[model samples]
Target: MDRNAKFIAALKRLQGVAPIQVWPATVKSIQGTNCTVDILNTDLIDVDEVNLRADDEATEGVLIVPRVGSLVYVGAVENAVDNLFVCQVSEVDRVEVKIGNSLVTIDKDQVKAVRDKCELTLSDKATLKQDQTTIELSSGKVKINNSATSLKSVLDDLTSLLQNFTVTCAAPGSPSAPFPATITQVTQLSTKINQLLS
Candidate 1:
């Protein structure tokens, strides 16, 4: 063939090769760990039973499951429908990273990290929460808050320690009456403080 004809034939062959399809999709429904989504493009309509991307060797099974209506990425081998797969969950308005049950989300106003039942945040101040307890770190001090019963128990323990405290004079000889009087005053002060705490 002439050079121009050979070049044209090569171009035709290249056009025949199918290209991989990747597009953003909206999650429709979830069944177990699998989900369905509607692709945003006109070529592919909808994909069903798409599994969420998770670690195969994870002992905790699937932890992070995308909610319905969230955006995600879908991929397929050329135009093969059965080979379609959910690549990753896409954060539409924020940047989020998830691994198993751990998640970190970042936005213009705040940053949050969560793992299991614990959540940590960093913004104008830093905060952490585990179950009902919260610890906030800001302005060079750490403030912890817990259940009322827990705080009361701590106070009770302090009261008991103070009530049972004994002061002994370090002198080799018997202390004078003034020393004994000072000890009595300290014990009375401890009792008053404990009563106020209670």
Candidate 2:
């Protein structure tokens, strides 16, 4: 089944014995592959259930903080009026990247995946990938290919990756430099380990 349909199906399993209602939704946009679902239930529900059910491979405890976003994915039930409602919060009036960074501007549709950006931007599909890797990230898709690079190259990659952000990197006593750590280091380490194992 399509990702959205599968996500919705997974979401269905989480509805409790308590009377629950899924408000009408739309396919606002696709963030990589998985779709967003703005479920307007009577009581605000936990978002992590959707992530857990959508992909059975992962299992993590979920804690919902005010103002933080969450996801819910479900599988299919035939004759159950299954339709894809890929709606994401498309208007990100304020998006905070790192732990201590200020909010920034972005399109509302792509705001679903704007968690703490530490080199890696984790998606609802639950894939670790390079974040801010392009000017136009239509959807956050994980490309399966390991490309080797040196320290300089990695730094250059990060510089370019965060070039557009407004957060000032203040470690070097300069205003323009960005915060120093990113998921890039993890990528480099993985590449080295793979090379050794190979």
What is the per-residue lDDT of model 2 for residues 124-175, given as tens digits with 9 covering 90 to 100?
3333334422222225632332345334454555566566344556578776
Error of 1 at 95 (Å): 12
The Cα error of candidate 2 at residue 33, in Å, is 12
lDDT of 2 at 147: 46
Per-residue C-alpha lDDT of model 1 across residues 1-198, encoded as one tens digit per residue? 999999998877865696556778898876655678898865555578775644433444333456679888877756576666677775433555766788888766788999999999999889998887777889987666565434444556557656765556667796634456556756655654554334
Q: Ten consecutive residues with minimal summed lDDT in candidate 2?
A: 58-67
Task: Show where candidate 1 strays beyond 4 Å.
Answer: 1-19, 41-46, 54-65, 92-155, 164-198
lDDT at position 12, candidate 2? 75
For residue 197, model 1's alpha carbon misses the true position, in angstroms, by: 24
Please give the CA lDDT of all the candidate structures.
Answer: 0.68, 0.37
Superposition-based RMSD of candidate 1 using all C-alpha atoms, in angstroms? 9.9
Report the number of the highest-lDDT candidate. 1
Per-model TM-score, in order, reads 0.39, 0.17
